[model samples]
Every structure is written in structure tokens, then in C-alpha cells.
Target: MVKPATAADGRWDADPLLGLVAGCYVAAAVAPPVVFAGDAGLSLAAGGLYGLLLGTVLAVTAVVWVAVARARSLVVRLGRSRARWLLAVAPVGYALGGFALLGQTGIAGVLAFFAGLGAALLGIALAAMAHTRYVAATVDEASVEWDGRTGWPERARRRWRRGAWVVIGVTAVGFAVGVLTDRWWLRVAAQALFAGGVGFAQTGQERRYVCTEAGVEQRLPVARRLFGWATFDGYTRTDEAFVLHRPWRTDLRFAVADIDDPEVLADVLRRHLD
Candidate 1:
């Protein structure tokens, strides 16, 4: 979690002006590819390469800037402020403008624009989610009862394996159809199905869980999720695991063996649920 900056610590307070500057930098980095493509008569691939180079340079520059003690404070403040949302809009507008400019070039340019836009949007979403998890982990007065890594329970593993098998079967059928019908799109669909099946098979192969005062945090390989106390009605304890009951979502099961002290963990849950 990002700690608040302090004058006493010789750190400057967050400045909204710094945030505006950062937003401008981001816009400049992301918004020039389409213009470059049109003016230089560049191909779709060249436009994408140019965008990648600009984004990489900007990321490196931002990293160096944040490494400075005073600038780091400003970055933390910007992340926590409402102004950050407004800053995000500038990039979206520029990206849309770039897309419009690319449309005049050709269909290939339009497709390249959308592909880059999709990747940029996804990266932003993941960064936001990670920041939220970091903040949630540092909730005030939150005590951590148990923290460890574990895999899915036998029941859940069996269910996932069954689902994976079904998906794999479908993928096989799709591949056969693609070969018989000589359809490139069908082949692409088959490849996607195969990837999904593989992902399903690997789901929950490893996970880290933290039971804290404010909530339970589950960290997967690429994602972090928090299940707050208010979201769950209660929990049920079995010999091997604790199952948290949510009103509208699937229950979360934590293995008892993964906890250092099951009784202490139970006490923490009781204090919240009871």
C-alpha cells in the first residue's frame, strides 16, 4: 500500500498540477500513432510498432520519475485523488481521436487502432484493480490472523476438472470441423477453446489467502480479490476447511491446514460474523 506523504518526512504534499502534467505525458505517449501512420503513410504493423516504442519510453520515464523521493509522494497522492479519474479521460479522448484519424488511412489502420486501444484499456484496468487491492490490504486497525498459500479443495478441483474436460472435448470437435470444412475462422475458434480449457484445468493450482480484520484477501497469479465481511452472511466450519457464505456469490473455501492456528483464525471470523 502507498503510505501518505508527510512534510515532517521532507516529502512534498501531492499536487494536482503534477497529476495534470502526468496525464499530459500519458496522452502524448498514446495519441500520436494514428497521426504518424497517416502523415508518414506507414503500414498497420509499423504504426503498432511506433506506439509500442512510445509507450515503452513513457513507462521508463515514469518509473525513473517515481523513483525520486518527492515525485513518489505526488504519484501516491494522484492515485488516491478524484482527479485521477479526470486525468484518465484525457487519454481516452486522445485514443479515440487517433482511432478516427486511422479510419481515413484504411481498414488495416482501423483494425490496428482498435487492437492497440484494447490492450491499453486492459492494462489500465489491471493497474487500477491492483492498486485497489493494495489499499484494501492496509485497512486501518486490520489484524492479520492467517496468511499462507494453498490450492483448491478436492471437491472444487473435481468440478473444475470436469468442466475442463467438457471444454477440451468441444475444442477437439471444433478442430475437426475446421479441418473438414477448411475454415480459418473455425480454426481460430478451436485454438481459443483449447486455451480456455487449459486455463480451466490450471485454475486455483496455487493461491495465497490472507484473513484480516476488514476482510479476506485472495491473490491469484495475475489477480487480487477482497471479500469484505459485509458481503458474506456468515461462515461454516468443516473438519478440513472454512466456507464463507455469500448471499449472491459463490462461497469461498479456505483450507484449515493452510492456517498456522485454526482456532485463532476461527476466533477472528467469529468476532466478525457473530
Candidate 2:
């Protein structure tokens, strides 16, 4: 059983199975290397694909079971927003169809897989652009005299450059692997994994974040998100990051050096939380 991550407050995180959900995709990406680390890697990429499928199955099964268990209370608990949430099923449906189509042979399969990969990244960039384009966005992120581009400009800039470099390097390596490998599936896997790496790097770029009376608003280049104080139960510091522990299993985090006026930011963050 997947255990829920505990906040300092000792409450269960709302999503107990987020790791499993994420692992489904992660498994898909790493299964190849796990099974066929050697030169003899063309077993239909059988290990990679089967592991992916298994993770998908487990994730879906877990989600379905949880949904069913809570079905009776969903509408009343979720209220009028239930319909809006249900509409999210459309994307899940598309995900299922998209993956099924990827298994096809010939040009159709290639197009479906790569197109889907590109579309996801494109969608994020477009969505982020929409926040600033459509929403009247402002920020108190730089509230401290030492905040924003002026103080942390170099830090954020370096991070952005690093993210770009990682994606470029991964893409180059994927291309070389695709050419040298005898298996077509290997090529597809390499590209897909590298594409995911690109997405990860893109996400690492510091979003335009603002602290407000209600909470925090993140205006990322690829997406926008608002997180109320209630969304986070506590804060935790690790060697690498300062984390806002969310109700969900995952925490939102920032590097200590990435944001300007670290001490001031920490104070503001603590003050805002309920």
C-alpha cells in the first residue's frame, strides 16, 4: 500500500497515491535501461514497454478504486464544482487513446507519439502565456527591496540557462541513440524520454510568482497556478530546497539561492500560512 506523506501537522495528504501515478510514466522511461543496460537491448524493448503498461494499469486501478470508494460523497462534498471536475475526464480519455495509438506500426505510430509529445509541451507554454495575456497579473514577489529580477536576476537567469542546456544535451543524446540502435522502438523510447526531460527543464525555469493576501500565484512561462495558504500544511527545509508541503503528497519547493531575499521570503511564507 502506498503510504500518505505526513505534514508536520500530522494530517494525511489528500492524495495518497501520487507517487504511483507519477511512477507510471517514470517506469515507462526507465524500464528500458533497467532491463537492457547492456549492448543486447533489442528485446522488443519488451522490458521497457511492459513495465510501462504495468505501471499504467496499476495507476489506473488505484485511481478507479479510490474514486469508487468515495463515489457516494463526491457530489455533495465537491458541490457544484463536480461537473467542472468531471470534464477533466476528457483529457484522461485522450491520454488513453493517445497511448493506444502509439503502439501502431509505420508512420502513423511515429506521428501519433511524437505529435502527442510535442502537443503536451506546447500546451503548457500556451497556457502560461494565457495567464499574463488574459489575466491582469501583478506581483508582490519582489516586495523585499532585494527581490525579483534585480536581486535574484543572475540566479534565475543561470537556472534558465541550465535548464535549456539539459534539454539540448538530452535531445542530442537521444538522436545519437536513435541512429545507432537497431530497434525502432528504442528510437521512440529515447525520443519520448528526452522529450519528458525537456518538459522537466522547462518547468524548472522560475515562474513569475507573487505573494498575495489570499495565497501565492505562480505565472510560469508554460502555466499559471494559484495556491491558497490552506493548500499547504507546513514548511520543510532540505539540503536542496525549501518546501511548501501541500495537502497532496508532493510539495512545492524553491531552491534557497534561486529566489532573492531568502530570509524575507521565508518570513512572508510563514506569515501567510494559516
Candidate 3:
């Protein structure tokens, strides 16, 4: 279990699981580049051997880094922002996907395929575990002011309803066309559109939210998000909700009516924003 952030310094306990996940991410990120470098080095007489040796050293370094308590602490500190932590791992996914494509058509292809699949599955598991642990720790340790469920604003819900219909229509048409034309890519696109339509259809569903001194926790239908005070620059109040603004990311909207004490929530936000 992860430890909550201490009130004194606001630092969380360095959980070993966090360190292990970080180390695995580091290894995944290093592997593809190292393999490419080794391939490139084959042109030189001894460059391939050198590249292999360098890769081994880096791999060992990642393992040792995970073993150190201070290093784990640093990783835990950095991962405090769940959004940032997840974003950091995105490149690993891209790298693994690219490697899988590059090595297609041989034993190398099979290895890359399994590697990518395993990494993706492992990443999901690690993220879920870390998020659960941190949220539990936060709730246990922090002063929670309000905890309840909220729905999207009526206006937003209406917009999503319209959008969902359009998406579903397009998906149906696309699928029909793909079937007639026998195009695999078009079928894939239609499937993606259908998935998106499902998301749009769920827009007005009620979601749980927790307001605490540390941050706001949003438990949406598909995922749980913890938005720490540090993640947002400021917020704007609407008739129905308070919108937390962040740079280059979607803003978080908390329904004011759904919260029991608006003034207390406002004060809590003010203390953090100020």
C-alpha cells in the first residue's frame, strides 16, 4: 500500500511498486532505441559489440535505480501528479508499437509483438494499482470536505446527445460502405467511431467526486482521475459548475449543485489557487 503525503512537506512514502513500474518503463523505453542503435552499429567493425555493452550497462543501471530507496522516493514525488505520470509513459507505448511494426515478418516480429502486448498489459495493471493505492492513501490521510456524485451540465449533456447520434450515424454508414467495398481499414475506422459514439452516449451519466485538501478525485464511468491542486492554474465558476483549467489539457468540471457546501468548497479551492 502507498503511504499518504505528509502534512509537513507534502511528500508521499516511496512505495516500492512505484519504483518497479518506473524501472520497467525505463527498460521498455531503452530497449527499442538500443536495438536500433545496435543495428546501426553493425556497419562498423566493433560498434555493434560496443552498443550491446552499453545497452547492458543501462539495463543494469535501471535495475539498480529501482533498488535504491532515495531513487524510489524521487520517482514517487514526480509521480504525485497522476496525469503527468500517465503522460510520461505514453512514449513507451508509441515506441513499443513502432518496434512491433518495424520487426514484422520474422522471429523478431513475434518477439516484438509479445513485448508490446506484455508491456501494454503491464502498464495498464501498474497504472490501475498505483492510482487505487494513492487515492486510498489520500482519502485516509487528507481532510475531505465533500464526497458525492455529479452529472454533466444540462447544456453539455444536450451537446453530447447530438454528437453521439451523429457519430453513430457515421459509424453505421462507414461500416456499410466498408462491407460493400471489402476494405479492412474502413471497417477498422468504423469500429473506432462506434467506440467513440459509446463514450458520447455516456456523457450525462453520474460520476463520483471527492473534494479534499490535497485535490479533487473524479471517478468517471471509464476511469478515475485525481487532480491535485498543483495541476491546475486556476478555475472559473459557471452557473452549474466550477471549471478547473490546466495548460494544454482538457479542463475539469465539478458541478456546484452536486456539492453540499459550495462556500466551503470555494474556500478550499481559493486557498490552493491563491
Scored by lDDT, the top model is 3
lDDT of each: 0.61, 0.48, 0.63
Which is the winner by lDDT between candidate 1 and candidate 3? 3
lDDT (10s digit) by residue, model 2, range 1-274: 1122224212223333422332233333323233332213444455555564456546554554354334323322332122433322333333445466555433234333443454444333333332332222333443422233211234554676587678768777777877887666656667767776666555444555666654666655544455657778888765555677887454566776666567776777777662
Candidate whose TM-score is highest: 1
Better of 1 and 3 by TM-score: 1
Candidate 3 lDDT by residue in tens digits, 167-235: 999999999999999997698689869978987797666688777776788775544567777789998
Model 2 CA deviation exceeding 4 Å by range: 1-122, 125-175, 201-207, 221-223, 237-242, 247-251, 254-264
Error of 3 at 132 (Å): 2.7
Q: Per-residue alpha-carbon lDDT of model 1 for 1-274, expressed as tens digits?
A: 4456456333322333333334434444444553454345744465665565567546644543343335554444544454645544444555555566665645434544554454455435534543453444344434676677766677777898899999999998999999999997698679868987997897746588777765777766655566778889999999878888988766777777666678877887898887
Query: Candidate 2 at residue 78, lDDT?
Result: 33
Regions of candidate 3 where Cα sits further than 4 Å from its true position: 1-126, 137-140, 220-223
- TM-score sort, best first: 1, 3, 2
Error of 1 at 139 (Å): 3.9
Model 3: how far is 155 from its true place, Å?
2.5
